[model samples]
Structure formats: structure tokens, C-alpha cells
Target: MTAIPPLDPPARLLMGPGPISAYPSVLRAMSAPLVGQYDPFMTGAMSDTQELYRQVWATENDATLLVDGTSRAGIEAALVSLVRPGDRVLVPVFGRFGHLLAEIAERALAEVHRIEVEWGQVVPVSLIEEAILRVKPHVLALVQGDTSTTMNQPLDEVGAICERHGVLFYTDATASLGGNPFEADAWGVDAATAGLQKCLGGPSGSAPITLSDRAVEAIRSRKRIEAGIREEGDESASDFVRSNYFDLGMILDYWGPRRLNHHTEATSMLYAARECARVLLAEGRDAVIERHRLSGAAMLAGVEGLGLTVFGDVAHKMHNVVAVEIPDGVPGDAARGALLDDFGIEIGTSFGPLHGRVWRIGTMGYNARKDTVLTTLAALEAVLRRFGASVPAGGGVEAASEVYSGAAG
Candidate 1:
């Protein structure tokens, strides 16, 4: 029998659109021993994980917990539980993630209404409010920051509009969570979900979510107790949910004091998620956000100095990621390959309509730093030159250094 070649993972500087780079501490935490799912220590660890996520999300939602899947799983659980069939759901599309919201809402059989804008721009709050007032949706779904377009939709005003219209508000913060400012409670967000893979610096298995009382009430109204879990003396049944594994109601019961068995909790992933939150909160949210903000600004300036134009409105751009146009003569994919092969760096390409037209550079979580920014800029400049884009040597690195030094003073 043939044996697999020994996998030698080269050290990579992750400056990509996502899965930026996990912190060494988080990686070390994952290497620790695993415990039984129902062990007493495991239950205690579960409680700690909930508390850690609550702090990171800045919410007191008692139902705050980790879903045993990727960020999309948490998204599905929230949407499926809150949006019943025939309910009016309003989705505003500004980029790829907006399409994601619409797709999920469609599967829930919602009467979905959309107010769309161009790819690089976010829809105005007035337009969203007008749509909500006209359609009077039962739930309003939005993505706080759509990384595809490098735009962040202003959410505070929309939240207020939802309150006035009696519509429940839900948002996906998967890409923006720790690297940007997010106030789940203050923004009046009813339900929000995020992934550990991005700014959290953890593996992709666990998704952290927080739900307000109203969201809980909505899920409670649609709860279903499974046959195996139902006691013989129980007289009442639940309103059957659309999907079993993605059911938020059943998940809540499992995480609650009753501690019923659901999926075997991804123990290592949970530990990593907990540690990610621990590391971030230990440094304070504002400081961590500021780190990403500064690094991202430096990257934008550096890219511009290299004769590249950034995509989207700079004023409304996300703090951790930048999208830059691929120059006319440069082959985008080839340049990316050069960066990885020659510099041991990983950056990202755009998706769908924007693919090959732009490249996305990220400064997120543990990877948001001066050294990473400087290294990436230097490498990008060299790679673009290799592709005959004619970038001046040291131009990108020089501009980035200027930004960092100026900020220091």
C-alpha cells in the first residue's frame, strides 16, 4: 500500500479575505486533551464558553451559545426558527452576503422583498425604511459588513426603523465581529451570528450567536420536542420546526441546564472559540478594533502608492479588509500565485461578479499588525512588478511605514 506524502505545511503569512490566521495561543489550546461530551468538567466548560462569547458580543442574551457547525449553520438556525412560512421577510442586497440572506429566507418560504443597490455601495437607510414601511415585514434581515464589496451597512438607524415597524431584526456579523465595532444590544439587534474563523482566530467548526428576548420568544412559540426526548407523562407537543439539526429551539434546550444530548459538542473547537474571545476581551474590544483599523488604513495607502485603486467608498469601508482593483496588464490569479510561492503569503480574490477584477487584503484578529502589513505590502509590490505592472520598488512598503510612524507620533 502506498503511503501519503508527509504533509509539510509551510509557514504562511495570512493576509487573506478570511481565515486570516489563528493566534498561536488558540492553536495551542486546540492541541489540549479532549474530554467526554457529558463530563461534569465539560458542562462547566460549556458555561464558560457561553460567558466568554457574551462578553465578546457585548450582549446579555441568556441564550448566547455556540452552534456545532460553521457560521452558515448558525445563520440557518436563526432564520429557520424566526421566519415561519408565509411571513413577510425584507432583505436588502448590497453584495454577496445580501444574496445569502435572500437565499436562506427563500428556503424558509418567506415572502421576501429586496431593495438592492450597486455592488460597491450600500443601500441608503431611507430606502430600507421605506421598504419596511411599505412591505411591513415580519422580520428584517441584513449583513452588517459584506466583505465581498468591502462595505459596511449603517445598522443603528435600521434597527430603530425595525422597532417602529414592529419587525424583528437579524444580522450576520461573521466577517466583522471582533475586528470591527459591533453592539448587538445597543443596535437593537434581535439575533446575530458570527464565525470563529475570521476575527476570532479559531477553527471554522463553531459558530457563536446571541439572541434577544424577542427572538427567544419567537423560537419558543415554534419549539418541538423530539420523540426520543419526550417523556411519557408529557401532555403537550411542539410546533414542528422546518429543519431538525439547524433548529435553534432544540439547541437552546441542549445548552440549557437540562443539558440534553444534541450533537457531540465539538470540544476542541469550543476551547479554541473560548480562547479567542478570551484573548480579544483581555486586550479590550476597542484596542483590538483600533489595531485592525490602523493596519487596514496602512494597507490601503500602501496599495494606492503601488498604483492600485481601492474599490468602494472609503468612508464606509470595513476596518479589517480592503478591496483593490487588479491593474489592466496584471493577471490577477498569477500575481496571487506568485505572492504565495515566493513570499509565503496568502491573500484573497473576489467572488461572483467581482472575481478577477479585484483582490482582497485582510488585516484581521491576530494578523492585524505593523509587521504583517509591512511584509504583505512589500511582497505585493514585488509580485505586481513580476506581472509587469511596473510598481516602483519599495513604494508600497514606504507608504505603509509612513502611515504607521505617523500614527505612532
Candidate 2:
């Protein structure tokens, strides 16, 4: 037998820009004893999870449930199930994630129409509305927050525009779910998907998805199952839907009363997701958003006080993450490595044209606390000073402390 290596306990710190440290309670929930997939208690837990996600997504849709994968899986499941061959789909490309939506639409064999803008800027609702009018697509796909650019797309007016054009609005809220204000039903989001890794304070495995009646109808029309496998007089289903594993029609049945077999449920991930939702709900959705808002603002002020420029317009930035332009003559990788190795802090770098150009600092989930924010700022100032930058000593820490003090008062 091969020898198994003993695992070392993980070092704890606030995680920024993703997989933000999972809550201790959520980790404990995942440690619960495993139960049979069809056990009564397990089924009840499943139902409860769906209920929790409905509250988290702020939706009344009956089809709301957890997809057994990461946030991208939820996006794929929604896109693959909704768009048929040659269907028209409109995507407003603002960042890397916008390209993701376009890619998913292409995989669904949809004729994609894209309206793109500069990376740091968000797509105006009018631009998206104009694209909808021009393409007249059956589905309109967008991302609620693209962490790549640290921008949150304005969603308040998007649903109304889609409604006027008879287009179903779909959004990937993976980076914005717990930290930002989102209302699936109120925003007219026909289908929305998110992950637990960002601001949800849980491990990244399960993907929560909510579907409006309109989205469900579109999926239901294409429902199918394998043929030639039913007993005599069995009302076997059609084979209309493309992929079995990602088919939302079958997934809904499996999650619903039918209890049909799809993929085996990712039990631990479900538990983690449930606890994550429990944490958010217990905090009150608005309060959770407020916490993120304050944390992000503090981080922004601290970075600026250190003689750094924030990349995006402050008026439009997401409340959980911020992008800052790297200082000239400073090697971005070396600076990031110093923070991680020496200070045990990790922030992110960007993609595409932004590679090595900006530092994506995040104040999200478990990392949004005052101490974490202050500590990150302090360490960042130290690192910048080492790189010959003219940052005033203690400037970042002092600026962040003021934000915390003001908020508490």
C-alpha cells in the first residue's frame, strides 16, 4: 500500500480576491457525517438548501436550486439549457467575464452579438439596450460583477430593457452575491447563477442558481431523456436537450419531487453552501452588503493615502474588490510575492491587457473585517516603500483607521 502523508493545519488569514477565507462554522458544517443520498434527512437538507438559496438570490422562482459544481458550472448549465441551435444571444462585453458569457453562448450554438467597452469602464444600460434592439436575441447574457476589472455592471435598468425587447435576462453573479445588492426578481433577472467562493464565505464547489418562470419555460420546452430504456407502456421522455449532465430540465426533476437520478449530489459542498447562506441571512442581506461597502471604501482610502491611484471610477466600483494601478518602476510580481511570503497576505493580479498592470485588492467575506483591512494596508505600505515608492509611512493604516472610526461613530 502507498503511504499516505499527514496533512498540516492550514495557516489562517483573511483571503482577498477569491476563495476568501471560509467561515469556521461553514467548515464545521462540511465535517458532518455523510448520509445516504436518498436518506430522508438528506433529502430534507436538500430542500432546505434550495429554500436558503431562494432567500439569498431574493427570488420566488420554484426552479431555484444548487448546481453541483463551481460558479462557472452554473453559468454553463443555464446557458446550455436555454439557447438552442442558431438562437440569437446578446452579450455586453465589459471585461474578461463578458468574454466568458460570449463563449458560453457560442457553445450553445447561439448567434452572439457583442457590445464591448474598455476594461475598467462598465457597459451603460443604453448600450446594452441598443444591442438588444439590434440583435433581438432570445437571451441576453451578462455578468453582475466582473472581478477582473473590479466593476459591477448596472443591473437595475437591464431587466426592463430586456423585458421591452422580449428577451430573457441571464446573469452570472459569482463575484457579487453576498457583498453587493442583488434582487433576482426585482431586477428582472430571468436566470441568475453564483458561487460560494467569492463573498459567500464558503468553499467553491456548489453553484446556486435561480430561474424565473420565463427561463424555466424556455428550458422545459427542450426537456429530454435517454431513449429505449423504459419499461413497457412507459412514457419515456424526449431527447431534445443537448447535454445530460448540464441539462437544467433533468436537474430540476432530480431536485424536485421526482427525485430522478442525475449526478450524485456533492454533499459536503451542499453543506458548506447551506451554512454560507445561513451566515448571510442571519446577518440580514442589507447589513451584509453594508459591511462590504464600508470595508471596500476603507481599502480604497487607504490605498490612495499611500500615494496610489485606484484604477476604476470610484462611483462605479464594486463594493468587495478594488483595482489599483501599479507604481512605475515596481515589479508587480515581486511586490505581490513579498506580501504573500513575508506578510502572509495574498491579493490578486489581473488578466488580458491588465496583466501585471494593476493589483486587484479585495475586502470580501471573512476578510472584510476592520483588522484585516488595516493589516493589509499596513503591509502594503511596507512593501511599496521597499520598492522605492514615496509612500508615507503609516499613511495607509491611518487612513483606514479613520474610516472604521467614522463608521462606528
Candidate 3:
């Protein structure tokens, strides 16, 4: 047998769209000793986490909880648990994640309907209302932020439209939740799912989710007691949720006072999720959002100062990520590699229609700091020059500093 080295990873400053640096406190929380799943402390921690996420989502829903997988898992759970076979689901596809919602709905056996705009733009509320009226869907699935095009779809009016049409409204907030303004209750959202890696400053294993009472009712209607756990008088629905592991009804029982056994909880991920919420709340949710806003502004100014043209409608761009057009004659991937290899910093590449045409730079989560933004811009300026692109000396950092200076004033 050959000897292998112990795990050691390079220290890279992540300035990409997601999976950015986790908060130091969250990392420490994950290292804490574990307790049995049913132990009082474990349950107490779970309850505390639920309360924290309620504040994070700005909702008073009692059904707020964590899903044991990534953000997509949360999305799938919401779709599969609520949409029965042959139910109509209307997804307004502005970018990639919206298509993801529609695809997940399709896999859940939904009769999916989609209305799409150009990739960089958002679907207008009027168009969405028209679609809702035309399709009369049972559920309206949308993405609050789609990183592929760096667009943040306006969701405030869509929820009201869904309500008027009696459609359940759900949004995947994976890339936007903590970094952007979201009001689950005020927006009339039926369900919202998010991950910690984007703006909550944690590793990407657990998903925090909240459900309106109406969404819960829809899920409960499809509840099924698993075979081994079936007791006398336990009724199972004919259209029960297909996946046992992703069953929100059973998961809710496990999280709620019922204390039913589902899967053995991911204790470390639970801790990380808890700590992520705690740190956000301690910093004050609005204040943390403001941090992301300021950081994003600085990065934008820096990129524009470097003579890079930004993609999409700047007015509707998300506060946490931006897409910059790859300068002509610059090998996009090669430049990104040099930035990583020489500066130990990592920015993102685009996806879908944007692939190889633009670079996606993120100021999100723990990496959404003035220092990180300035550092990334400085290194990028050097890389651009090395790649035979024309960039002014210190233009990027100087422009970024001006933003910070104005904010300080």
C-alpha cells in the first residue's frame, strides 16, 4: 500500500458566484462535538436554528426548517412535496435557475409551463400575470436570483399575482437570500428555499427553508407514513410524495414537536447552519445586506474603471454578483487561471449563453468585504495587462477605494 498525505488545501480567496469563504465562526461551530440525534441539546439547537432562520427569511411561519442537502435539494423538496402528478406549474424563466425550477417541476410529474425573456432581463410582472391567467397553474415557481446572468428578478408583485390567481408562490433564494432584500411574509411568498454558501457565509451542505401555512397544508395533504413507521389509523394518500428522503411532511414531523425519526440529522451541518444564522442576526440582517450592497458597488466601480463593460441591465443586477464582458483578445479561462495561480484568488466563469463571453465576479458571503473586492480587482488588473489587454495602472483599486471612501464619509 502506498502512503498518502493528510488533507491540506490551498488557501484561495474565493470571489466567485458561490461557495465563497465560510465564516470562521461557522467553521468552528462545525467542529464542535456532536450529540445523539434525539438528545435534548440537539433538538434545542434545531429549534433555535428554526427561529433564527425565521428572522432570516423575515417570516413568522412555524414551518421554517433545514433540508439535509444543497440548495437544489430544497428546491426539489418544495416542488415534489407540493405539486402532485399532472398539476400545472408555471415557471417564469429569466435565467438558468428558473429553468432549473421548471425542470425539477417536470421531474415531479408536473405539467410545466414556461414564459421566458432574454437571459439578462427579468420577466415583467404584467407578463407573468398574463401567463398566470392564461395557464392557471397550481404553483408559480421562480428564482429570486439567477447567477448565470447576474440578474435579480423582482418578486414583490408576482406573489400578489399568484395570490389573486390562487397559485402557490415559491422562490429559490439560493444565491440571493442573505445578501439581498427578501420579505417572505410581506412578499406573500408561499415557500422560499436557500443555501448557506452564497450570502450566509457557510459551507454548502444544508439548506434553510420556510413555508407559508398554505404550502404546509398542500404538503400535508400528500403525507405518507413510511412502511416501517406505519401505526394503526395512520392513513396514506394515493398521491403521496414520491421520494421518502425529500418528503417535507415527514421531515417536518422530525423537526416539529412530533419528534418522529426521519434520517439521522447531519449534526455538523446543523451546527454550521445555526452559526450562519446567528452571525447574520448578530450583525443585524439589514446591516449585513448593506455590507453586500457596498461591496458589490465597489466591485462594480472597479470593473468599470478597468474599462470592462458589464453585462445585463445594471439597474436590476443582484447586489452580490456581477458579470463583466471578457475583453476582446483575452483568453477568459487562461486569465482566470493566472489570477488563481499567481494571486491565489478565484473569480467565476459564466454559464449557458454567457459561457466564454464574460466573467462572473461575486462579492458575497464572507468574501463580500472591501479588502477582498480591492484585492481581486488589483490582481485582475495585473492579469489583464499580462494577457495583452489595455488596463490603467491602479485604476481598479483606486476606483474601488473611492467607493469605500464615499461610504465612510
Candidate 4:
């Protein structure tokens, strides 16, 4: 057998769009001893996690629970559970992830309709209202933030628009939930989903989701009995949720008081998820958001101080990530490599429409700190200078430090 060495990974400072460095407390939580899926302690942990996520999601959803997979898993569970076949789903496409929602809805056999804006700009709430008036979709699915183009779409008004038209509002908050202001109840979102990897300060694997009473009823109407739990005269829906693993109805049954069997729960990931929320809530969601705001502004100033142009509409950009244009004569990926190899700092290269045009720098999760922000800006200046692009000496870090000086909130 071929032998592999002990796990000694490079000491990297993750400064990219997602899967950023996790919180130390969250890591420690994941290392605690495991318990049986249905153990009393395990169930208690599950219930605690549900309540914590209710606070995290800013909702009073009784169906708040964790989907034991990545952010995409939570999204699918919500979409498939709430949308029956032939349901019309409207998605406002501002960036790549919006396209992802439309694709998932299409695969769910829903009649998908999309309203698109330019890649770096947000889709206005008025436009979404106009689309709803025109198409009358059953469910309005939107992305709170799309990291690919660094845009955070405004959902404040869209929710009321959906309510007026009797449409269910579901948003994928994977990239924006912990770092930005997301009021699920105030925004009138019927369903919402997010992951730990981005601003939640934890690793990817578990997806936190919440469903309003209205959204829960949508799933219950189409539930089919589990084979083992079925009685002799039990009736079944003619149509079942297409994917067993991604069905929110059965998942809810597992998470609910019935404690019915589904897949064995991911115990460690559950612990990590719980810890992430506990820390965030203890820190105060508003304060955490303000921290991200300050750090993001500092990063933006630092990048601009280095003579880099910011991409997208800054007025509506997500607070956790920023897109800076690659200068002429610099190879985008090569610069990223230099940052990683030389300075042990990692930033993201763009995808799709923004590919090779811009670099995505993140200030989020555990890495959203004064030191981490300054380090990234400093290292980026070095890399730019190494690539023969002229940059002012000490300007990047200086600008960032200036912002940090007043960032006590």
C-alpha cells in the first residue's frame, strides 16, 4: 500500500471569498467526543442548535434546523420541499449564483422564470416587482449575495412585493447571512438557507435553514410516508419529492419531536454549527455586522490606495468580499499564486463573466480582523510591485490601519 504522510498542511491565511479560516472555538467544538445520533445529549444539542439558528436567521420559524450538507444542500431541500412540479418560480439574476437558483428550480421541475441585471450590478426591487406582476410566479427565489460578482441584492422591499402578489419568498443567504443585516421576519422571507463557510466562521458541510409556517405547510401538503413508518391503509401523494436526501419534509420529521429516522446526523458538524451561532449571537449580530462593515471599508480603501480599481456598484456590494480589477500586464492567477506561495496569503480569482478580470478578496468569518485585513493589503501590494505594477510604498496597510483606528463598533 502506498503510504501517505502525517497531515501537516501549509500555514495559509485564507483571504478568499469563502471557506475562510474557521473560528478557533468552532474548531474546538468539532473535536469534542461524538455521541449517538439519538442520544439524549445529541437530541438536546440538536434542539439547542435549532433555537440558536432561529436567532441567527432572525426568524421565529418552528421548522428551523440544519441540513447535513453544504449550502447547496440546504437550498435544494428548501426548493424541492416548497415547490411542487409545475410551480412557477421567479429568480432575479444579478450574478452567477442567481443563475444557480434558476437551474436548481428547473431541475426541481418547476417552471423557472428569471429577471436579469448586469453582472456587477444588483437587480432593483422594483424590477422584481414588475416581473412578479408580469409572470405571477408561485415562489420568488433570490440570492442575498453573489460572491462571483460581489453584489448584495437588496431584499428589504422585495419581500413585501412577494406578499402583495401571494408569492412565497425564499432567499439563499449563504454568502451574506452572518456578515450582513438579514432580518428574515422583518423582511417577510418564508424560507432562508445559509452555510457556515463564509461569514459564519466555520467550515463547510452543514447548512442552516429556516422555514416559516407558510413554507412548512407547502411541504406538508406533498409529503409521502416513509416505507418503514407506513400503515396498511396509509395514503400516499401521487408525486413524491424527487430526491430523498434533499427532501425537507422527511428531514423535518427527523428533526421534529417524532424523531423519525433519516440519515444518521453529522454529530461533529452539528457541534461546529452550534458553536458558530453561539459565538455570533454572544457577540451581538449587529456588532458582528458592524465589524464586517469596517473591515470591508478598510480593505476597499487599502486596495484603492494601491491604485487598484474596485469592481461592481460599491453602494450595494456585500460587506464580506470585494472585487478589485487586475491591472494591465499582470497575470491574474499568477498574482494570486505569488500571494499564496510567497506571503502565505490566499485571495480568490473570479469566475464566469469576471474571470481573469478581477480578484476577489475576503474579509469575513474569523479572518475579519484588523490584523488579517492589514496583512492581506500589505501582501497584495508586494505582489503587485513584484509583477511590475507601480504601487505607493506603505500605502495599502496605512490606509487600512487608518480605518481600523476608528473601528471600535
Query: Which candidate has the highest TM-score of all?
Result: 3
TM-score of each: 0.96, 0.96, 0.98, 0.97
Tens-place lDDT digits, model 2, residues 93-190: 88999999999889878899899999889998878887888889999999989999989998998998888889999999999999999999898999
lDDT agreement of model 2 with the native: 0.89
Q: Give the alpha carbon lDDT tens digit for every residue of 11-83 in model 4.
A: 9899999989999999999999999998999999999999999999898889999999999999999998888
Q: Is candidate 2 or candidate 4 better by lDDT?
A: 4
Model 4: lowest-lDDT 10 consecutive positions: 230-239
For each candidate, the alpha-carbon lDDT, in order, equals 0.89, 0.89, 0.94, 0.92
Model 3 CA lDDT for position 5: 92
TM-score of 1: 0.96
The local lDDT score (0 to 100) that residue 315 gets in candidate 1 is 91
Off by over 4 Å in 4: 228-238
Error of 2 at 316 (Å): 0.9
Off by over 4 Å in 3: 228-238
